[model samples]
Target chain A: MAGKQLFIVTGATGGFGSAILRQINLLYGEDAVIIACGRNKPKLDDVTKGFAAGVKHISVDFAERQGLKERCQAIFDLAAGETFSAAYLYNNHGLASDVTRLAQDFDDSAEIEDYFFLNLTSFQVLTAVFLKNFSGVPHTCVNISSKCAVVAFPSMSLYCTGKAARLMLYKCLAAENPEVKVLNYSPGLMLTTMTENFHNTVAVDSTKKTFQAFKEGNLYVDTDESAKKMLGIVKEGSFTSGEQIDFHDC
Target chain B: MAGKQLFIVTGATGGFGSAILRQINLLYGEDAVIIACGRNKPKLDDVTKGFAAGVKHISVDFAERQGLKERCQAIFDLAAGETFSAAYLYNNHGLASDVTRLAQDFDDSAEIEDYFFLNLTSFQVLTAVFLKNFSGVPHTCVNISSKCAVVAFPSMSLYCTGKAARLMLYKCLAAENPEVKVLNYSPGLMLTTMTENFHNTVAVDSTKKTFQAFKEGNLYVDTDESAKKMLGIVKEGSFTSGEQIDFHDC
Candidate 1:
């Protein structure tokens, strides 16, 4: 039990993050140490309580740029100086639906800047911190992207831009840093809090119907199914370090 | 002559924007007014002076969020209640060459955010401003993207992410706004200021050699040739709105 692998999952309070954590616990047994990170401590505790004592919860707001590296370093230090066999740095934190609405309403540059900072900057900071501190070979950084990253949907401009930038960032990091296994996971349209608003506000009936189909599993995926597929891909590990692994295929 | 069409060209001092301005002047005669926009007022003046009195220069930093929409609205107002027939919003403005170095040395979140704002948000703002105000049909918005938008490159994360976002933004806008002509131009591997920096700093001697060959017309494209081909494409207007036009075929 002492020598088992360690996994780090960000946004652990979210639907996708919780699903992934559940899958890992189920597959890897109670020996595996799962570091569940989220901004909400109560939510984190609730999520991790069911899991074995091996699960440790860490809470840190990535948007607070002051001493982010130091905070990440402290997290690494608490891990008993053990380098992970594989680290899953899931940068899954995202904005509420109203932010997308704000981005769509204004052509103002300042508002756009704020959106970029919130959605895009946090991903960059977390990635850099993980890469610098985590000395794990064949380390996996699974960036949670969306269908918005590939196909652009109306009224989700802020979400679309941020997700798209993260996709490109992963690609760049893959090309630059060949050692780290970088995967862009497009967990195709789920019924998360993010999608609920998307369902409510989309003007076109066809678009809403399509999102409904996706949510109802008539289209493709949910958090649990997507997480299972993603875990399968991680276990397979046949892909190159910087390859984009779409969960739908698995 | 008084009723001739109006066009707005952002980053009007640089390579692609300047060339596009020159070609438009040649095609539309002295009646066509080109509103040259950039942060560099002196350079804008120098670039537009040789053209007919129809050319007007405006200095505005699109990166600044405060009052950007108003400032852009003023530019449109200068057309004397005449909306643009087409707006070539080419923001060829880039950051310092030490961007990758800074991202690596310092924290990249803020800098990456800035890059996204400059490259992606500026385009969005300009497009929104022009589309909302202008009533003309067949109104064109040509976004100058790079090869990096499609293919990931090392040490150019900012450029790559920003360009990718720009490309997708145009795609989304094209899908949503069928009335507006949105074109994504991937001027593949041009001998631009951005490329020159990559050749100098990076250890990739082969890339530098290839760039040199390109400049010497040994590889594939020179600036003039690329510009001429792009101008022909723009003039033909054969491409569907939101079509991604790569220079490799041109």
Candidate 2:
């Protein structure tokens, strides 16, 4: 058996997931296998190619509940039936949108429901699947929550509610299953594709200007730095099973 | 202006809501206007009949976002036009269900979405509407959370997640709006209609047995006792604005 660790990263094509996968490969050498997962196959492939040869790509639309159980089972089967030494079930995938615009012009329930599905329900289904399949002790589940989870910002009601709900879900699950090391991580104010899109689409010029000011220096951190900090936390195992860790401190 | 205080109670037909409303009416007298809000108008009327003529009934479907907002606005308009003294906004509405069973047996996402709407989104929307519209200063927002909000319970995932999310929402809102006194309260286990239904329909005997033990003096407090304790806390006003008060302590 290979002594190297296996990491399953969801939203691998996304900013934080991509950065974390790259950093893990850099740190652990070529022996690490990264099961990079996302709904978009082409993007997943594009992101995985830069990684070492052992890094494999998997495409699964977790939002679609149909056949999700079987699909996850297949992934577990493909992992050679070996329990992962460590897994970063990073729920980095989310709907990037301008909440101010939505708040102004579109307060539709359907739109809110769509964001909730992508951001919250998918996380719930994935957590249930992983908890059932992986009984490995010392397993870590790292959820990528936003600052919105802690504070309610105006205009981003959908994103705020979804992220907040997901954080609570993980907290409850972590409390229930004390054996699993569940971390509710707030990757504070990363100037990634998501935040860039949010900035571009912001309706108010003042709000946009404020975001730009923050993006220039104080409010943003690169994905690589976030990933390094998070991985360091995991390595140290300093947190209790259900503790929340923010990126600013990480 | 009447010397009595005004109270707004959501889910007024529910056990805890009714109990709290009764206690408030007894303490404050017939001049107090208790706005009983719920979908079941007839039940609310029946419950509040003997209490006071000042009691008003507002039939509201909590899951209907637009309808809820409109109803809340109407209530605020009525209260403002009357120039009531102090106001207490008690968020007592919620739905508790066996989430594991629902997830396994039910395929309808609409059902799950409706559950969240009633239990989570309604709290957010209602609180926002009340805070925005009501001019009553030194206003109190009392949120009735659950023990499951703090501790994870099997089969009650929906309730757990909803209450937990709302608790955090109240916390966030309290932090932002320091002028408003927000109370996140857990009434502990109560022998409500919801619990009775839970005991009746639970698939597992162990769950039913545990609930029976809880119901028969093991894990629950009397609704009247819990309400009295909560009212005492409200009267004292010793707790900080963002503090959470669990009635189990009383």
**Candidate 2 clash figure, as a count:** 0
Best by TM-score: 1
Model 1 misplaced stretches (Cα beyond 4 Å)? A65-67, A71-75, A96-104, A215-220, B83-88, B96-106, B136-138, B203-217
TM-score of 1: 0.90
lDDT of 1 by residue, A119-195 (tens): 77777776777776655445678888877787777656667777887798788777766677788888777777767
Error of 2 at B19 (Å): 0.7
Whole-model lDDT per candidate: 0.69, 0.69
DockQ for every prediction shown: 0.53, 0.20
Docking level of model 2: incorrect
TM-scores, all candidates, are: 0.90, 0.77
Worst lDDT run of 10 residues, candidate 1 chain A, spans A96-105
User: What is candidate 1's lDDT per residue for B1-250, written digit by digit as tens?
Assistant: 1356677777777766676677777676676778877667777677666776388778877777677788777777777666445545444544533433422333555556666666777777877777666565356777777787777666666677887888777777776667666778876665556567676775334435556676687564566566667767877878877767888876
Chain A TM-scores of all predicted models: 0.86, 0.86
